[model samples]
Target: MTVDIENLIDGESKFVSFSEKISLPDAYSVNGDVLVKLSGKISNEKKGLFHFSGNIVAVLNLNCDLCLKPFNFKLDFPVNELFSRSIHKKDDCLSFSGNIINLEPVILDNILVNMPMKAVCSNNCKGLCEICGHNLNESDCRCEKEHINPKFEKLKALFEESENE
Candidate 1:
């Protein structure tokens, strides 16, 4: 949505509404899907300021770090932003250009900020089997469970010899 600064020049207050399907770049493109639903309410108080608050909903196709399996995850978050034409901007204020204020960047910024630190399919995800490269969440593996890999056997022996010395 674009807000016209001229509308508030006549001492008139206005509210602009927006609801649309927007697309984000492939920065997070594991499955090449980054479309989202963006909806918001922007209001001008006629005091040379605009307040924008909204929510973003998107289904993220992410790979589970442990299992390495692709899964569909729902991501939703709220956005609170302030836009103004004043030269004296607040700490979190964004400045607009000319007589128009574009909202595309604002919405994308909020979505990036609200992204999860980690993506996991479940709390107790069994992850992948190391020996057979199988997804443990789906099936069980007969491979013996060892904390240390056999490749590090020499390092373990050296450390054990040092302990005896």
Candidate 2:
């Protein structure tokens, strides 16, 4: 995604919009191409400084962390950044050389930063059963419900004795 600033005059702002599917090969968790929609304004602040302020709407295909099921995740966030023609050693603004400013890097950075640490299909999702590796969301597992570690055997005997008395 690139925005043309050749016609933008100093102190003038132009509205920019883009709707496209972008491939995110760096995003390991993303299952497919991301649908990105960007709407924002790019303003020429000075001779070489420009400011871009806008909103992004993206749809990502991801797998649920719990059940490993595929799902669509929607992300909406605001972006405000600076672009400069000259590079500064300690500057945070992105540097651009030509009249066109590439927004792909900015969009990718924002999407990655805003991504959730854990992706869950739903709050009530039932994960796979540990013993049989069955999908608990689809059906119940026949594995024993109560399981105690060997280290807790003494504790279990104590509880049994107390119950008998």
lDDT of 1 by residue, 8-114 (tens): 65334455556555666665536554667666666674545777777777777777888988777777888777787777876777888577888778867776776
Model 1 regions lying over 4 Å from their true place: 1-23, 147-165
Clashing pairs in 1: none
TM-scores for all predictions: 0.71, 0.84
Model 2 misplacement above 4 A: 26-29, 147-165
Which candidate has the highest lDDT of all?
Answer: 2
lDDT of 2 at 59: 82
What are the per-residue Cα lDDT tens digits for candidate 2 across 1-165?
898999899999999999998888646346557779999999999968999999999988778888888878889999999999875622878999889999999998998899989998888989888888888999998897667687788898999999999
